[model samples]
Target: MELTDLAPLARSSIGFDRLLKLLEGSRLPEPADDYPPYNIEKTGQDAYRITLAVAGFGPDDLDIILQPNLLAVSGKKADSEARGKGFLYQGMIQRPFRRVFHLADYVQVRGAELKDGMLVIDLAREIPDAMKPRRIEIAGGQARPAQIDTGHGG
Candidate 1:
């Protein structure tokens, strides 16, 4: 869909005004996202884990990609393995898939490992020094912040 096609949907929600403003006028065509199923878990205070079900995809067939605040995991079967004779009914969900995740500020992908057909993606929240609360240095006695009333009555 074109950018204009999504304009009407943004106006339907009152709370979405802030998000719409943040997105500005830039638009990305809707993508036909893949679905093989996944799970996101809060592993620690500042850690998270994303587990994707990739039953037939091995470690070499998967790729973890990070783009600014977006993380994507894509997988494809390793060149159709030569099956032995008498093998039939490929029932496993072995198709290629790509999954995307939107990350918050300071969030970083720490590690990724595949085990038993499950792809685990580790994430950690990196609190920037500027954004973290720091104790203010008091030079003996610090002056209070000033509040200026710039409005003048006529």
Candidate 2:
């Protein structure tokens, strides 16, 4: 319903500003449109898939963009004289639409495909080598005693 107040967290935290901003942005209500419905699914441990029902759209009519932290998908029918022709009862919607997806860190677009009136976008989270968890070998021996040498001649 409402965004939680994060001003107190902002004061104590250093790099959580982005999270706070995301939460604030989500609080704003957006117009609900069921047109061009979509589904997000998890295919693998670190892989995801987004499928959109694009009945009349072709590959050329769609555009997919990858921003720093967002994935945007848009569709626009190409201009043509035939499209202007009058139709008795047009039920299918060919209007342009844009959809955005917020991505977490390290998430990247793998590929996309259009099949049987459905557009599928694949994503995978590939963590960098430096950031992945690694095992550290701990020392496995007892501490050695310090050697002492007495002064030679008094």
Candidate 3:
């Protein structure tokens, strides 16, 4: 499944091109709709966290890699070496899978932890001082005067 020309017109903005690409790439290899369920949360103005339900997966079975602007999560459950017991009905899942998430500009993966059969991935975004919203001070009674520099070179 892919997002059809996802918000193309957004390119009119100054720095939305990269965002489009990130969205596009993340959609390429759709993460398995199954396996450990996950949730993405926005904690602060620039902080985010992804929680995954990895019931039978242990810390050693999971791997998190951060490269440049890409964050990838992968989990591989160890195969069982038990005898085939008589079971008319069996309902258990044990498969390996990988999920990739593209991080936007200034977004960084902080860390990941497992607790209560849940895997949590932490992310944070830090905007530069100049980029963050700022209020321009208005002088009470100040008029800016422009000086015209005429090049008078012989």
Candidate 4:
């Protein structure tokens, strides 16, 4: 299903303007550009993991960048390594690729690692103490009236 209009939902929401904007501006990846398949999984209540199948990419050939609320993962084979390698089938893709992910508020990149031909990226949402829910202590019992002190030695 496709979402065409979000104006009605945006008008009724209070603090979801950013979310609505993001949804409206979101675009699916091109069907023909499905290279280096990836998976995103929720590991914990506030933790997430993104695993990409980078079969021919090494640690030095990949770069993970985090900026504001964006995460970009890119990989490119070295010119020296790609040259003089005449393959019979050439099934493995060694071309440069860049993938970007939009992160939610307070979500941060914890770390990343390349293991078993998979690039694993770890993320966690850490809400600040000031933004967390807190109980308000309500004062009970009798109320006291304050006396007003006027000027002119009153």
Candidate 5:
């Protein structure tokens, strides 16, 4: 969808212009790469996890970078020319890839791990105290009436 499609949302919403920019920027000009599949799931109320199938890739081959508003995951196969010498039917894919994810405000990367050929990344959203909801105390009653004194001769 184009930015024109989001004009209604932009007009109706407030403080979400960055969201529109992110959505517009995420659209790839070329066809999306399907290699190295990944999944994002909500683990808790404010926690999330991203799992990527990275078979034949070691820790040295992958790089995870967390920027202010972007999470980039890149991988480079180690010396494929040396390993790809002879393979009649090579089904395993070990090509280089770079995947990027847009992060919302207050969303942070907690940790990451590679297990069973799966790279799992943990994320959590931590809203600041200033943004959290707060309750206001109400007064029990109204103020008392004030007495006025008039000037009189004693």
Candidate 6:
């Protein structure tokens, strides 16, 4: 099913303005370039992993940066290294690429590693204690009895 607009739904929901805004913003046109395919998987309840197929790129050629709720992954081969590569049948993609990801609140990048021509980036959602759901103790209607001093005079 295709989602056209969420304005009506946003009007009915409470405290979901940001979520609807994100959904609406995602409907915008995406980049035409599909270089360096990637996958995002949920490893755990709050853990996630993003793996990119960077066959022709290495650790030095790739850069991952995180700012606020944005994540950018870019790769570019060195000028000297890119030169002297004369290929008759060029099938592998070696061009520079930049991919940006919109992260949710409290989502942080834990680490990244490159192995077997794939770049893996680890992420986790760390909700603060104050933001987590907590149980509130309900007090009963019964009141405690007051203690009277029946001391020395009595």
List, in order, the clash count of every candidate structure: 0, 0, 0, 0, 0, 0
lDDT of 4 by residue, 15-128 (tens): 987788778777544457867789999999999999999998999999999987899999999998888687777878878999988999899999999998999999999999
Clashes of 4: 0
lDDT of 6 by residue, 42-83 (tens): 999999999999997988999999998889999999978866
- Order of all candidates by lDDT, from best down to worst? 6, 2, 4, 5, 1, 3
lDDT by residue for model 3 (11-36), tens? 56676777676666667775447666
Per-residue CA lDDT of model 1 for 21-92, tens digit only, reads: 546644654466657788999999999999888887878888899987689888887554635434577667
**Which stretches of candidate 5 lie above 4 Å from their native place?**
1-4, 8-14, 25-30, 80-85, 138-154
Higher-TM-score candidate of 3 and 5: 5
Residue 149, candidate 6: C-alpha displacement in angstroms:
26
Could you arrange the candidates by TM-score from highest to lowest?
A: 2, 4, 6, 5, 1, 3
CA lDDT scores, all candidates in order: 0.79, 0.90, 0.77, 0.89, 0.87, 0.91
Stretches off by above 4 angstroms in model 1 are 1-34, 82-87, 137-154
Better of 2 and 3 by TM-score: 2
Cα lDDT for residue 148, candidate 2: 73
Model 2 steric clash pairs: none
Provide the RMSD of all predictions against the true structure, rounded to 1 decimal. Answer: 8.7, 3.9, 5.2, 2.6, 4.6, 5.4
Model 2 C-alpha lDDT per residue in residues 1-154, reported as the tens digit of each score: 6558878888898988778889888888877976689999999999999999998899999999999779999998876833686888878888889999999889999999999999999999999999999999998888889877787755
Candidate 6 clashes between residue pairs 3 or more apart in a chain or in different chains: none
Error of 1 at 144 (Å): 14
Q: What is the lDDT of candidate 1?
A: 0.79
TM-score of each: 0.65, 0.83, 0.63, 0.83, 0.75, 0.78
**Which pairs clash in the backbone of model 3?**
none
